[model samples]
Target: MSRVRVHNFAVSIDGFATGEGQSLDAPFGHAGTRLHEWFFGTRTFQQQVLGKPDGSTGADDAIARTWNDGIGAEIMGRNKFGPQRGPWEDHDWNGWWGPNPPFHTPAFILTHHPRPSVEMEGGTTFHFIDATPQEALRQAREAAGDLDVRIGGGPTTVRAFLAEDLVDHLHIVVVPIVLGRGERLWDGLEGLDQRFQVESVTTPSGVTHMTYTRP
Candidate 1:
């Protein structure tokens, strides 16, 4: 059976996935890109995100490379799509990832205000929907077909899916930083770890990688 998954999701030591006051100017907010420094250093990130050739190799790169494995569709919060709140002012704002997004599949955006689907280059189609988590999963599952659906999150989205117990595979990278105030991944999620078999390992980059998968 196909699965709903979260991959390479970063969080701070204080359990913050992103800092407060997220904006178009500051996507990661006060925490900045400090949360993703380990990712940027990986060869997989250099190739996939930066479209570059040279980067470090090791456990981090290996984990980064798996972000796209067997994933046919992506579901993300409106916050992950952009920093905009309320109704969107700019209809032309495709996303933070330029024209050719990495997903290369149907990427579902969960929002209260829905919009017409935007088709982008490299086989990525942005479909906006206002539905409950279960409803959204149904759409994503159909779009995914034989492959798995990835929950590409900004904390809130992941929390919602996790709350509904829809996620089957979760990969969280814990950065060794302390963001005193930010959106937390563990809020209202007590005993969430019990749902999956978790395996943790500290990488050479001073970050711990945790993978939670159901048996």
Candidate 2:
């Protein structure tokens, strides 16, 4: 059976996944690149994001490597794709990942206003849909076939799927920081830890890698 997973998502100590004022200028809002400092030095990110062959390897790299392993499809919120809002003011937004995206699978973008699918250089084809988290996951699962479906998110999207109890495995990296005001991940998720077997490990970089696996 294919599982729904969340990998390598980072959140601040204050529980904010993303800060206030998300726009083209600041994709991560005021939080900036602080949340992703750990991933930036990983071999997986170096190869995928920077198109480099060399990077740090170890516990962090091990976690990063899981990103593309068994994931056949991905579902993300509109904000994850870009900062454009309200019916996609311009149709030219090809996501923050440039021409060739890292996701080499059918990526479902959840938005209120749907648009035609956009095929990038790589195998990543963005499919925009206005549907419930369940509906979107259904399409992603169909595309994934025997492989797992990854929930690529911006907090809100991940929380939606979590609320629906649709996620099987969740890997979150808690970065030590305090984003006073922003979108929080643990909100409205009271006693969510009971649903999964949780394990936490502190990496050399001080980022705590927490994995939640549903039994």
Candidate 3:
């Protein structure tokens, strides 16, 4: 079955998904980039960006491989896509990722502004959808075909999906660091009774790879 999944998402020791004061210079917010040290040192990420296999093949590699595999479509919130608030410009602004982005599948970006579909190399088409998370997921699932729908988020996006209980699986990489302030993954989650079971946990280079599945 086609399911919504958050794979290889990094969270700090203090439970912040990103650092505060996000800007063009700091997309991940302040020192939020440090949380992704595990991914940056993986062979999968190196190969995806540099076209070279010069990274480790241990726990980090296993987590990276799962996150990077068979993703038919990706859904990202406006904040995650770019800092652009209002209507997007022409096709000039592609994305943060360069020419050949890491994601090779059709990516659905959630935003209030609407734009035509953007076709990029390696089969990455950015589709701007002006709708709620549920609606976006429906469209993404259709676009994804047989592959799983991956939620590429910036905290708020994931929170919205989680609130709706639409996520089937969530794989978070808990990094050993602390961001004084930033976007948090579990904030304002009040009396809502939600439960998840740990599927697996592996330590690769001190980074803890945790997978949780809805029960």
Candidate 4:
């Protein structure tokens, strides 16, 4: 079976994955790009996300490069897809990632309101469905075939999968900042460390990269 993995997931020292006031303007809410500032400096992010040639080829880039490794499909919460809540008022808003998304595989969006799948340019077709974490993983795993399925997250989506013990490998980047308010990643998950063999390494960027792999 293909493994369920999360990569380059950033959280503050206080465990908040994203800040409050999420809207069309603020994708990470008030958190803005603070959580992912460590990533932006990497060559992997510069090339893959920003389509740039120059970036730091340091320790951060080494781990960030693994984000797309063997990932055949992705499962993200509706919030990660866009800020629109309730029924999607406008289908014209494809996603934050322009016409061509970075995910070169099928990306499933978990939402209460299911809509027809939106096919984008870079081989990413977004499928919206209302399902539990298990059900959504089943669909994503099926689409993934022999390759692994990635749990692309907002805090809620990652927390749900962690709560259900669905994740096989989790890579969390603990940024040094403290956001007192916002969506937290470790709210209900207590003793989560017991389930996985954990390892941590602090990079030159001042972020601690923690990997939790199931034993």
Candidate 5:
């Protein structure tokens, strides 16, 4: 069966995946790019996101490079797509990733207000739908075919899937920061460790990468 996986997901030491006060100007809220500083210098991020020729190729880069491997589709919360709430006041707001999104596959956006599917460059198509985690995974798995479906997240969505035991593999990067307030990734997920065989590795970047794989 195709696996449901999450990769390069960054969380603060306190478990907050993203800070509060999200808006057009502040995509990650007050946290800004602090959560992702470890990833920014990776060769994978440099080539994939920044289109740069040179980047660090160490332990961090080694783990970050697997983010796109065998990913046929992605499921992200509406917040990860953009900061808009309620009815999408603007249809012109495609996404934060310009025309050529990095996913290069069908990307499903979980939302209360469903909108028309937007096709972008690089074979990335955004489909917005209102459904439970199971329903959304069904659609994503179908679109994913034989390849794995990636759960691209914004804490709430990831927590929902985790609670349901739908995720097969989870890679969480624990950045050493303390965000006093934000959307937490581990809320209501007590005893989550029992579900997976866990292992951790601390890279020289001072971030700990934890992998949870279902046994």
Candidate 6:
């Protein structure tokens, strides 16, 4: 069976995946961009994010390399896909990833509203599913074939999956920073007793790399 994993997902010292007031200008919210400095400076990130190849190999490279774990398909929430709340007004916006998004594999987006699959540059196909997370996961797994189904999040989506105990492995990059108040990764998820034992931990640069497997 294929594993459902979250790779290189960054979180603040204060337990915020994204700061408050997320907008087009600030997707991670105010001061949230600083949390990803470790990734932004890495060679892997420079190539993917800035479309440039000017970064050194070191701790950053090692951590950034883990972001792409041969994922065959991606699943994310509508909010993470975009800020267009309620229902999608139209197909005018595909996502915040621009014309050439990172996830080249098929991506399944959980949404209440329906929309046709968005075919973008770099072989990224966004399929909007109106069903629950389990349904979306099933589709993503089928689309993934032999590779793993990656859960890309905006906190809530991950929480839903975590609550349901659907995820198998999780990788988190804890950055040394604190956003006093923002979208927390663990908010409203106190009752779920699904405990994940630590698989391994790597300290690359200032970021703490940790991996957990549901056992």
* Best candidate, lDDT: 5
Candidate number with the higher lDDT (2 or 5):
5
Per-residue CA lDDT of model 4 for 99-177, tens digit only, reads 8899989999999989889899989999999999999999999999999999999999999999999999999999999
lDDT of 3 by residue, 89-117 (tens): 66577888878877899999888888888
Tens digit per residue, CA lDDT, model 1, 1-215:
79898999999999999999898899999998999999888898888877889899899999888989999899999999998889878698899999888889999999998989999999999999998999999999999999999999989999999999999999999998899988999899899989899999999999999999997
**Runs with alpha carbons beyond 4 Å of true place in candidate 3:** 190-194, 200-204
Misplaced by over 4 Å in model 6 are 188-194, 199-204
Model 5 segments beyond 4 Å from truth? none
TM per candidate comes to 0.98, 0.98, 0.92, 0.98, 0.98, 0.91
Candidate 1 vs. true structure, TM-score: 0.98
Weakest lDDT window of 10 consecutive positions for candidate 4:
85-94
Ranked candidates (lDDT, high to low):
5, 4, 2, 1, 3, 6
Misplaced by over 4 Å in model 1 are: none
Clashing residue pairs found in predicted model 2: none
Model 6 TM-score relative to the real fold: 0.91
Give lDDT for model 3.
0.83
Question: Which residue pairs does candidate 4 place in steric collision?
Answer: none
RMSD of each: 0.8, 0.7, 1.9, 0.7, 0.7, 2.0
Residue lDDT tens for model 6, 3-95 = 898877888878888888887788887755787777777788888866898886786587567666778999998878987788676789888
Model 5 Cα lDDT, one tens digit per residue, 1-215: 99999999999999999999999989899999999999999889888987788889999999999989999999999999999999988799888888888899999999999999999998999999999999999999999999999999989999999999999999999999999899999999999999899999999999999999988
